[model samples]
Structures are given as C-alpha cells and as structure tokens.
Target: MVVFKKFNLDKQSIEVPGTRVQGATGHYRHASYVNGLVEHIAEAPHIKTLYDLFQNSVTKYGDREFLGHRPYNTVAQTYSGYTWQTYAQINQRVNAFGSGLMHLNEVILQNPQLNRWSLGIWALGRPEWYISEMSCNFFNLVSVALYDTLGPDAVEYIVGHAEIPVIVCSGNHVSTLLQNASQMPGLRAIISMDSLQDTVPVPGATSPAKILRAWGEEKGIKVFDFDEIENFGAEFPRKHLPPLEDEVASLCYTSGTTGQPKGAMLTHKNFVATVATNREGLSIYLPLAHIYGRVVDTNATFSGCKIGYFRGDVALLMEDIQELRPTFFPTVPRLLNRIYAKIVASTIEAPGLVGALSRHAVATKLANLEAGKGVHHPLWDRLLFNKIKMALGGRVEVLLTGSAPIAKEVLNFMRIAFCCVVTEGYGATEGMATATVTLSDEYIPGHVGCPRAGCEIKLVDVPEMNYLVTDKPYPRGEIHIRGATVFKGYFKDEKNTRDTVDSEGWLASGDIGFVDNRGCFTIIDRKKNIFKLAQGEYIAPEKIENILMARCNLIQQIYVDGNSLESTLVTVVVPEPETFLPFANAITGSQVGLGDNVGLAKLCRNPQVNAAFLKELDKAGQAGGLRGFEFVKRMHLTTDAFTVENGMMTPTFKVRRPQVSAHFREQVQAMYADIHASTPAAKL
Candidate 1:
C-alpha cells in the first residue's frame, strides 16, 4: 500500500495520509497521490510490444491521418506543400517495409552462422524514419538510431557498436556514411530515402544515387532506393515475427556531452508502459532520433491521435502549428523561452495605446491567476489573449514542457495567454522519457508534480556536496527512480549498465532534487555538476544560473564556474543586446546604439556598464537568497550566445558544459588571474 502526503502552503504544514516505510538504506519511502488516488504502475496486459500498440491504434483510427510530411519540389528545389498518411496507409507502408526487411534477413541468413541482424535509421524527422523503426520491431530486428548531426567518427562508432548491416538514410547522411564506410566493416547496405532520379546533384559530383552506387560497388556493399524496397516487399509474403514484451525495441544513444555516446536499450514493454500512462493528441516537433520525441510520437500513435510533422525548418514551427491546429503541444524550455522573449519584445515595441493595452491585459491576467481567481476577463480575452491563443492554432488545450526547467514566469504567462493547462514533466533517456509528470489541474509553480502512475521516486543523501534529505524547508538530495519505464541497460556495456542501475533496480538520476511535503519534486542541480571551492563550499552552478536568468532580463545565457583552487565564483554571460543597450546607455547617460560591433564590444568592457551589471547581479543573487560565495564575484560578457552549431549547446538545447568551458578557457583563466589584481573586474 502507498501513502500520500499533502502540503498546504497557506497553512505551512504537511499532512501524511499513511504510515511511512523506512528502507534498509536509511531512506524514507513516502508515496504520493493526485486527485485522491495513489500512483501505481499502469497495467496493460494486452499490449505486449510496439507492434501491438500500432495494430490496436490502426484498428481504432485507420481512416484518420496518422503521419504528415512536407513535400519538396524537384525542379525548384524547394518545399511548397504538405501531405499526410492515414493510419491505414501508414499500416500498409509499415507492413511493406517490415516484409522487405524480412526478405533481406532471409538473404543475409543464407550464411547460417549469424542469428540476428540490426537495422539503422540515419535521417531527419520524416515518414520513412517512422516506417523503418516500426518495420524493425515488426520483423524482430533490432532498431538503431543515428543522429543526423553526428560527425563521421561518432557515426562510425555507433554503426560499428550496433553491428548494423543495413541503414536507411537521407542523401547527406549517405555522404557521411560513404566517407566512413571503410571503418564500419559490419555495414553492408544503404537505403536512400530520396530517389536518385529526383535528387539534385551535389556541386562537384553527380547525383547522390549514382555516387552511392559507384561507392557501394567499390566497397562491396549494396545500395537501394526507397521505392525499390517497397516494390520488392510488395512481391514478397508478409512476415509476422512478433516481438516479446521484454525484447529490446530500440537502442537510443545518449547525447555524448562528456564522452562517447552509450546506447540505452529500451524494451518494448518500456515503450508500451509509457504510452499506457500518457495522454493523447500531440503535434510532433522534436527530433525522432531522441527518445523524448520518439516516445511522444509512439504514444500519439498508440492513442489513435493525429500527429502533424513540422517542416524541416524549425523556424517555421509556429507556422506549422497554425496550420496543424493540434490540441496538444509538446515542447522544451528553449522554444518556450524564445516565445516568451518574442512576445515581450513585440508587445514592448507596439505603438502607443496598443502596447499599453497589451501590457495591461497581461498584467491583469497574471494578477488574477496569482490571486487564485479565474481568468475571466472577457474584454481582455477578446482583445489580447485570444490573439495570443490563435498564434498556437487556437485549439491547444494542453502544453507539456520538459528536457529542462522552464522559468515560472514563462510557464504562468503561457497558461494565461493560451487559456490552457500547461504541465511540466521530469524524465530522461535512461527512464524512457518520463518518470514523473505534473497533473492537469495541479498548478504549483516551480514544482514538476508527483511521480507518474508507474514510477517510484526517492532521494538519497550526498554527503560530499552537503546535500541531505533532512535539509530545512524541504528535504534535498539526489533523486533515484525505479519503475517499468526505466530502461533495461546500456547496450553491449555491462560495466556501465551495472554502474547505472543497482541490484534493487533503482537508477540514480544524477539530479539533485527535493520532494515537497505534497510530493511535488523540484530539481535543484545535477549531482555531478556540483563543485566544491577552496573553502570547501559546494556550488551548484545550474541552480545559480537558473536564478540569475529568471531574475535578470538582460542575461540571455549564462555559465557559472568554480574550482577547488578558487574561493569565488566566475561567470560568462551572453547578454540580450537589445536589453543591454538600454542599460549601457542608462549607465553612461548616452545613447549607445545597437549594431556597431566594435562599439558594443567596448560597451561590454566599459567600467560604468560593468559596475551597473554587477549591482544587478548582486541584487538577483540577494533575491534568490544565495550565500555570498555562491554569487559571481568575477564575470565577462560575450555577445555570442551558446549555440548547437558552435558546439556550445547540445541538439536538445542543453549547455554542453565541457565545450563551453573549453571555448571560454582563456576568459576563465583571465578571471582567475584578475582575482588578486588591483584592477576592478568586468562583471555582467
């Protein structure tokens, strides 16, 4: 039996419903509930695999559009349209693709020694990627995913590690694989999604198909176009090798921020269980190569919901949303942050009365929400909020954000602006994308709600960094999770697998968080990311970074660093130039205009401007109630923000700390060098 603890903020008290269970590890296990029901693992005995989920959905919603794609014009070399496939059509393609893989497997099995084969998809978000993935599960072949942005070396590593014999990829990916083909001995075939006849010729080469064919002939490998496989499969009998619930459905690779990417083996049961506990109806925008996006896609398919694909260009996502009019939008914090920044900028730039009215309407709505009253301002809703809602296609009833923590202000603003329920989820690749999620009606700021139906969560003390379960206000420690949603293990790495998951099945999340008396969890910082200074004061850079970002509008991006040799913290800030321009001008009492790169760079190093920013930083730190050592004592401002193309941010929009540190090594050293200097440090 599970017990629930309820916390009343107004009363400043906690009420536990049932007796607590003390584990042998000296940790307390307190189960929680939402809407009076204790969370327990969702049971789905009928659904055994991804194939079963798809079949069930096809039976229920065969005529509905299940997948969408944007078509490209061959002559003009531009995308001018969108198309969709019904559930029935999707089933047909999946069956044909599966049958084709089965036929290929038979051909490969003629050797009589090899018992298993793997299929790899190395493409962007497209219909064929979905078909190929499902086909692998359908034919009982292992499915391996390769990131489109991966370099030649990472590609070779993943291909060799998975022992993938066949790969389905786009033209660009074919070029990459061709470059590293000699290194990947097990890879035998390449399936191009685009037909050779329709593909445009690369600058210095013939058509990609011709190049691939010549290369394959040279390397003793076979290459096939997408249509050929479908046609061949149409002639062959369908193969029906059902996958077991415990069988590995897909091998998802980590983002490889610290080192070589490790594949997390996600079982069919893991996916099915995730879908069973998920809500339906979402427009897919995230990359399918990632587990977070893939789980959402699979869940939408399993729940008989229409999934609209974004145009390859992410800049056009808002336009796609306007066209698709999806009822649910699954997103990350970066996109939401951009949306918030754009809205604020546009509203501020609006001329005269328009700007005043927009600001007033937003302020009124936010006040109403904060006061625990209904947002029923009809006049404001019609004039302001309704237009805001229309920007998201006017049909979205729920918004889900995860992958990173979002600002409380942004989350609240979006809810009121869209007139919908916005929920945050907490999960990772190791946990199949979800271990806990916020309930529909539970609107607690900064809290990621309780554990999901199928998950159990607990906290363990980390004494080295001074995090303990008995901390004041709320218990703070490292979070550990155990559930059906947790992945099996890392593929082909027993040592890493053993290190990640313990004998009792609990996987350490590496995230330091605290559970509120109400069971709502709030993540503080990553355990591994915490560093101790020369004075033995532990610092959680992410915690300080989030606070500074939330409190300071001028800070677009920030990275905090400390070392055992240093007693004070140092920071690198990417300032919002538009916001910083006014501050700089105000500090100097002169109009320092934007777009003059040299002038802006000088302004970033200006003594007066730095002093003002340091004051702002100090205020923000004070507001966040940080210790004196946690506040940044030395800082440098850079105009360029961390970005994926620059290798400073991951594809998922997380700051690659190692990369950022390396890129800013000189600046870091300069900051430390000036620690004892007589000169005042530049601080922004």
Candidate 2:
C-alpha cells in the first residue's frame, strides 16, 4: 500500500456497516481498478503519482503537444511543436535553479518571518508559473500564488505573510512589484516571464516572453528562457527532490480570517487524493491551475493521461482547444454560462424563429435522453451545433463546471449548442473535489451529482448555536466530508484546523447540502453565510443570490446582509456591463447611463427594476423552496462589484465574507438610518 509520512493510511480507511443505507442508491458502478483488487485495495498515493504520470506521458504521447500557448495576438504556440526532449531539457534547467537553492534551509528554520523563503508567483494565467511551481517543489520551497488582480494590500499580505524571498512575476505584475519592492522585506529577486519595457505600465504585462527578456538584460541576475530552463533541468540531478506528499508544498490564502492571511497547508498526499478523485470522477484530461484543474491534472498525471497546458487567455484557450482539442475541460460555471450566453446570443436572433428552435432543440434532446435513447445527435450538427462548437474553439467532448452554481437555462443551452455532456462537481480547497455529476446527457439542473469513490458522507445535527438550526432532516446543515481527499491541516493554525475537521475525521465543508434518496447531492447555501433577523428567522443568501442571478443575467454578484438586524435586508449588487445593457435600453427606450453611474441612481429609481427584483423574491418564497421567514424584505441594490484589489473578494473570486461584511456594513446600516430619519418616531 502506498503511504505518506504524516497521514496514516489505516486510520483513514472507510468501513461500512456491511449494509447500504436506505436512502443511498448506487451512484456509480465500481471501476475496474477497485473491483480487480477487492481483497488488496491499495492505499491511494499522492504527488509521487503526479511525477510518475508525467514520466509516462513523456514516453507515450512524446511528440503530442503537452503544454501549448499563443503569446502574440496572431500566432499559435505549443510544447509539442518542439520535442519531448525539449520539455525534459526545460525541467532540467529549472531544476538546476531549484537544486542550487535546496540547501537554503533558512525558510523552515525561521518559522513565520517576513523573509523566510516562501515563493511568490504573480500572473493572471500563464504556464511559466506552473513551471516555476515544479521547480519550487524540487527545492522544498512552499509556493504562494497571488492574483494579478490583487492591489497593493493583497500583494502586501501575501508577500508579508509568506515572507517570500523569490517572486516570479509575469509582464503584468513586475512594474507593480518594482514600485512596491520596498514594502516586501525578503524579496531578493524578481523573475519576469516577458521583458519589461522602458516605460513601465502601472500594471505590468503578464506575458512570459517579455518578463524573460527583461530578466536577461538585467545586471547581476541570471535569466533563462522557458525552453532554456528545460535544457538546464537535463543536467540537474534528481537527488534533490523535495519531501513527498506529507510535506507542505503550497500555502493558499483563504478569506474569513480577521486581518492576516491564513495559509492552508496542502500536503502532496492531500493534493494527490484530490487529483485521483477528480480523475475517477471526470474520465478526461483537464488543464491544471485552478483547484479544479489542479485536482484533475493530478489525477490525469497519475493515470498516465497527458495534460495540455493553455496560456491563460480565452483566445489562447480557444486556439489551444482547436489544436490540442482537450477532451475534458475543467471550467468555472461563469465561463460556461458566458460561453452559453455568447452562443445563444450570436446564433439565435429572432425570438419566434431561431430562438424557439434553439429552445426546442435543447428540450427535445433532454427529453429523448430521459427516455434512454442514448449518445446520438443528428448529422445536421454542421448547420446547428457546429457554429456553437466553433465559438467554444470547436472540439470539446465534455465540459465540467464548478466554482459556482450554473443556471439551468445556461446548462440546457450548452447541451443543445454542443450536443455534448456538461457535468458539474463541488468541493473546496480543504477537501479537493469530492463529488461530480455523472457523464450522462440526462442532467438535472442544480444537482452536483454523486460522491467520488471511497467517500462517505452523513448529515450531522448542527450545534444549537450553529449556522443551520432547521429541524428538518438533512435540511441544509454543514456538509461533512470523509475521504482520502481531505486536506491535512492549515499550517501553524492548529485550533482553526482542528475545528474544521471533527474527531471522527469528517471535514466540515461549511456548505449546507443534502443528499436525496437517489444519492444525488445539491448544495443549498453556505452555513457560515447564514444570517439571522431580529425576529430570530435565518436566511441563506446564496439561494436569494441564485434567484436574482437567474432572473437577470446582468447582476454578476450579490451580497445580502441583515442576519443580526430586524426590519430590512440590504444587498450589494455588481452588474455585468454586457448583459445589463440591452435590458436597461428596453426599459428606458433609450441608451442608459447606468453604465458609468457608480451611484446606481437609475437602477434604484426605476420601477421596472424594482418589480423584477420583487418578482424573483416572491417566486423564491412561493415556490416553497425556502422558508417564508427567509424571504427578503426591503433591499437596496448597488452597481459596484467586489473585487480582490478592493479587498472584498479572494483571488479565487469567492466573496471574502468578513471583508465584504465589513466593507458594506456602512451601506447596509445607512439604509436603516434613512428609514429612521424619514419616520416621525425619530422626532419623538
């Protein structure tokens, strides 16, 4: 059996009562790997598996494009366009740098100082950062990913918290890093992917080529091209491989902490299990970067599946897809919905003709699949689905969505547009990804599907002072997870980490969800996000957020706050410029200025807008999907969006609950102040 240093394999095994639960049904047929080893079910290995998979692919699809990109506007780029030997060479070059620093044990020795040897990588989306991560792992350094969107404060937090000695920034982030260099204490060197220009832009370019060019010309510092770095790896010995799975490989900062950043210590094993689960769950190669991709990449590498890296722009992603044609896409719900919206908006114009046709086409396909006529779509795809496919950069077989909830309409539209299966899964950084929808076209809207192999779930009673206090069974308590995919713990914060996982080893997801009799799971909202009214009624904002988002595509994000208050619930709204424009024009019969109106004066004064909001609110209550007490009362909407730079959101685009609450607390309180000032009771 495979084993890591800290996590005991035997202690984490799953043993049932030898009887299946009454409500839990067969979600999946046991795969051959498990069925073949009934008596000798092996322990799941971790990051070593990732290394092994890459080695295998280095032999198998050696000439195939491993990582591809298009840096410039017109041309396409690729790893396979070179050679497998070239990739190996790049690894060697990067490893040399890592090996040179392997003996620098200064980071581990100095607990949590400002310059203790953590790595800071800044790039919105690029492959060089991934290459840098591999090098850091080779040297036993912890890699900290900072968002390019992060303004000075976020940059300061990560740089200050990790005490990052070396920072690898793309063209986009180098200028900012240079300007703010004095703030970070331990930053000895900055590596850029693309070359820096004479006149530095406020936000530097994130392009790899420009950073490298700049680094090469700099004095007293060594710079290597990506391919040249690969060459260096060829000469570096592999003896300096960092400690495996049990060792902390990366520190990811999560929101909800008071001021300082809370680093989540993800071991090689924790990441490995997550990758394994993602592989078994989705059956294809997914890009690596985001947590979903990270898990999928692990699984793919472990299973000898080849991963094709795309330089992080949608145009490049599309180009890579047409060239690489990745069978599996690990994407966020927003991206999928955006793709759907784009396809529908472009292809179907007249409401009575093409629009109705598109709708019917999607509904019919779904209805046919429900009847068990499987895996067949008409040849007229050239006229119908081809254009849609082209819009997605053409060749996608399966698309996996997560990171947020997807609208059912968007899902349906994609199903018809591509004539392919679109599945979804859910989990967090703490647990990797534990559940995924089945690879069938008969998809149920809003369902996250089944748990992965070897995962056991249960509904536990919330503490009387808990987030969810509903008496209903499995009625939206925190979703607890138990599996090999559960993370080890957060680094240095034992109390918070221990509080997250129970004595029985169940990882508290903090998400409120329930499993149906058929074993399918649906997330209702977040337990931590629940707020109570003065009347003692609780409301889950996600449900309301979803309802509003579904009603109007214009609202990108919504935050409802009023749990501890009595009379009214106030909301902060971030409107999508593209989606909101047409609707605004429809109501005004002229071009709307809500575009640059930061005050949202037009939106607040418009009765049509208020009516639409109320319509969604009433539907949510009367649909009986929510408690009557959970209904939202008077609300105020704003057009300003919360972002990482503004300190309202994390790098992953999740709303920083405490930050958001604190930032908008003034606005929320102001509504009540306006109410009291207008009333005669205030005079009394």
Candidate 3:
C-alpha cells in the first residue's frame, strides 16, 4: 500500500504480497523454483506444455467455470445474460474437438509429404476460438490464426506460408476465406465455429448453408459445422499426441503494417511460461489472435477463473460489462479516454452544488492518489464515484491498461473514481506479451514495471538514437530479452529472424527504453519508427502524438507524420465531435453545432477552422515540451477515426503508421505543398 515498500529494494524482490521475484529473473513463479530461472512451463514439471496447464486446471477446478457466453435468443432477437461451462465441461469439449478434427481430416493429417498439419483459426474473442485452438494443442497440430483485419493478400500469404489445411472459424469469415482459397494451395476444409441453423434460407435456391457447401465443393474443399465435428470426435475418439517443449504450437502473424504479414512461431513452452509470468478476466473483447489477449486468457484459465465474451458489438460494451460484473478490467487507452470524457461531461452538466462537489471530489482524490495516500474514500465512493465505477462493472478491483501509453491524468482519475489498482504493461507479440508491468504500490505513472520472472532483460547501445547503456541516472538503449517466454522465431524467415534475435538469443525488441536503478522501464522511442527531418532533428511521431493527445481535447486521434526528406512535419487529426464541433463553430464564427458528417467534413476543409486548430495545436505543442521542429506544420482534419475495420489500426488499437501514410497519401502531399506555397517567396 506504500510507495517505498513497492519493490522490496533488495535482491530478493518479493513482488507485492502473493507474488515473488526471487533472484534476478523470477516473477509470479512458484517458490520451489526460486533458486534460478523457471525451467518448466507453469513453473511446474507436470505442466510442461499448454495442454498440461489445461489438464491440471481441469483436475483442480473441475466444477469451476472456465468460459462464459451470452446465448442469443432468436424469437426475442436479444442476447441473454452470460451462461458458463465448467473446466471439466470445456476439457471434455477440447478433447472431443481434437479427436473430431483427426476423424474429419485424416488424409490431411496423415499425408506422406506433409510433416505436420497446421489448422487455421479466424474469429473474434469467443469460446469457439479457444475451443478449436485447445484441440490443436491436444494433438501436436500447429495452430495458425488469421487476424480479423488481415486483407485478402495477407490472408492468402499466411494460409499458404503456414500450409494451413483446415481452418476452423465463424460463419462470417467463410466468404473471405473462400475468396482467398484459390491462392491458398494448402487449404482443404473449413469448419464453422457456429452452426448453420441460424442461416437464413435462400428464396429460390437452397439454404445459405447449402450455397456455402456448393461453393466449397467447386473449390475441392469441405465445410462442416462446429457441433458436427465435436459429435464425430466423440463417436470416434483419438489419443492425445503431446508435443515437446520446443515444438511450435501457434504461428501468429503480425499486423502487416508494412508489406507481408510474417508469422511468429510461438511454442507451447513459450505461452505456458508467460502464463506463469502474469490472471483474472471477466470480459473477452480484445482479438484472440493477439498475444495480449491470448496470454490473458491462458492466465485466467490457469487460475481456473471465468471469462465472458463481449456482445461482438462495441456500442454495447458497457452494457455487457455491467451485466458480467467482472472483478478486473484489461484495456487500451482509447477506451479509457472515452470513459473519462463521459464522466467529465456528466460532471459538468450537474447543476449547482452537485457539480461543485464532483469537481472537488475528483481534485481531492487525484491529490490523495499522487501523494500515495490510497484510492479509497468512503464519502466519495457513496456520494460521487460509485455510479462511475458501476459503468465499468461495480466489482472491478483492478484495471490494467496497455498496447499504448495512457494519459497520466486519466490513469490517476480512473484510480480515484474506480478505487482500483491501475497498472500499465509493456510487452510485444515476440515476447508472448510477457515483460515489465506496473506494480500496484507505485503511484507514479509512465514507467512500466520491472522485468517479469524467468525472463532476463538487458539493453544494448543504439548509437543511431544517441542512447547508451551507460547514460545518466538511468541507462538508455534498445531493449533485449532472452528467456523461456521469448518466441522461437519468425516462421520461415531466417533473415528477419536473425535480424530480430541475435546469436546470443537476445530478442531485439526494436523499442528504445530507459531503465531506472530499481529496474522500472520507460519506453522512449521506436528505433525503427523514428524519422529524421532535413533540419537534422530526429522525430518520434508516436511520442509527439501522445503529447498532443494528452494536451489537446479536440484531437480524438492524431497521426503525426514526418518525412526524412522534408524539414517540416504534418498530421491527420481525427477530431472528437463533442469538442471539435463546438470549437470549430466558435473559432470560425460560423459552423456552430455542425455535428453531422457533412458539416464536420466542411469544417475540416474550412481555412479558418484549419488556422484555428493550428493555433491551438501550436499552443499545445509548446505546453507539452515539443521542440519547434517537432511541431506539426499543417494538418488535415477528418471525422473518420482510424479503426481496425479500416486497416488503419491494429486489433490492439495502435496506429498502423504505414497504412495511415498510404491512405492519406494525397492529403499529406497537399499539406506539404501548402506549407511550401504559403511563404513570401511564393508571393514574390
């Protein structure tokens, strides 16, 4: 509960109360193996593989709920409250599903030329996704996930590259998979995650299911439902084929922000080890394909806890959370920002003493939190904060935010209002999302916590960024990780694999960081993403964007772009309508209450509006400690926010910089051209 007691400040480093980081590399590990690095998965020899983790949980918590989902009612056209299945039940299903896959795809599994069959999983965060994936683990089959945002080209590349023969996915992805089937030479069968019962019947032709079957028939591929496979597996059981620790379990494809998506071959050992290194979740909303989501679910399952699915609709997210009443919430900054805005909006709208009380409460709580006094305030909780807390499931005891840096003020505000442990995580897919995580006692924001147990971390000098391991009070350089949690390597990419991880096994994270004497890390820059301006200034776009986002209320999302060839920088600002509409009207002395799409677009194009935003941004830049060269010279505003569906953002909510540049290529060029033409030379 105290700041000074946060890290024991000793070599032993007992992490919080229950957890212990003994020796140099040990976090969330069993005390029995505290002498050195955790050799076995789950910190136990018995649980050597992921399947073992499942089996042990099933044995220990047989009656405990594992997965929960809200069944949709056809008659009422509404989703019911969460229904759960015990660990024993899911274990049975996993066994049957694995057996069923063998029964259905014997030819593909037993093919002479193929060494091992790889199955593809393409879906949202749902029970079926995990069920099908666990089945693969039961056998020694490799599992490859087709990310939801993957375009046709990326999908085809992954399917063919991984040689994925059978794909188990929801009915929604069938069309896209089939469209890319022609180019995917290894694709053989498609198993539906859900049933075809709900599929509307065709008017003149056969049922939609039949139409899909016929389409598959033409491509020499077979299609079947999830239950069909499970039933068959139950009828014809197959023995479990446990894999070695070194065996690749899943081929996780990157978001392909650049060219082709490269698969990171993550082993069962890698995942199982990471699970020990982080548990508890009530909502499964993030993409299961991402390592962050996968590790969280594994940790939850290992602890024999329940995880309920979101309604597959973002608009109804809070509604589901209120119903589920999850004790913990793991999320990104964007969601928290929206929640903060809503809370602030409501606080401002409250009349008379209520508004004053709300303001007083927030300010007092924030001050108390910063001083390490604690998050609890009986008066504030009952009179002011309980309603806001209920908005994110009243039971939430912990809030974990990651994938991007959250505003420090918002982080503190959430801690005050929700009265929970708010922690930030620092990780990547290559590390299986295992790395530094903020400690509960550490009230200070920005720095990610110490190294996770079993993983040895070091920093090598990045001369290009002028960062050295011997710098000042804190050592700064590129992050290098080597441990049980680190991934095997990129699939069939020896060059890139070699580039990423060196001969000594240190996985070069490409992210520049500074580590304090206490081992807390603050990520400063992306070595690869930073660009140099013509005026000899190095610019980290993400850092500038974060600063601007924190300072400027009008900017919902901003992508700061810098060309190495040019001296100036520019940005594509996606404005939040709540602030932007009103500001635009006031700034221009017109366009008041222009909340519609057309009106917003017009405001974006208006020269006066652009000038006003630039002025505001200039002030914000100076306020946030941005250098003159780093300030955005020109901006193109838009109402369309970057999203997963638009390929502008990854599933984790991080901006795809390359995609952003390509999407607004013309706008960027125009902005730069205007900068060049607005000079006195052009007038002359």
Pairs in steric clash, model 1: none
Indicate the worst ten consecutive residues by lDDT in candidate 2: 1-10
- Model 2: residues >4 Å from true position, as ranges? 1-53, 56-64, 73-90, 100-117, 196-238, 256-259, 281-292, 303-324, 346-353, 379-383, 439-442, 463-475, 530-684
Q: Per-residue error at 204 for model 2, in Å?
A: 24
Model 2 RMSD in angstroms: 13.7
Q: What lDDT is obtained when candidate 2 is compared to the true structure?
A: 0.56
List, residue by residue over 174-261, the lDDT tens digit for candidate 2: 6576566567765655666664334444566455545544643442223333343343345444465545556776777664222455
The candidates, ranked best first by TM-score, are 3, 1, 2
TM-score for each candidate, following the candidate numbering: 0.73, 0.64, 0.74
Models sorted by lDDT, best on top: 3, 1, 2
**Candidate 3, pairs of clashing residues:** 26-453, 27-453
Which candidate model has the greater TM-score, 1 or 2? 1
Ranking 2 against 3 by TM-score, winner: 3
Q: Is candidate 2 or candidate 3 better by lDDT?
A: 3
Give lDDT: candidate 1, residue 116: 46
Residue by residue across 1-684, what tens digits does model 1's lDDT show?
111223333322122334233321222222423223222224335777888888887887889777876687868997654577888998898888778766665664343323346788987777888899888777777888897444456778898998888899986677667777899988778888877663565566577567678888788677887887887788895767788889998899874534577999999988877775553212233212112269888877765566667766676777777777767788877567657666765664478988888888888888887776654478888887787788777877778887667778878888888888787888878888787766555445787766665566777788876788778787778788777788999998999899889998888888888877666788876778765554334567888899899999989899998764466899999888889999898888777687877777878888788778978999999898666778898889887789999999989999988789899999998988887464332111
- Evaluated at residue 230, the lDDT of candidate 1 is 81
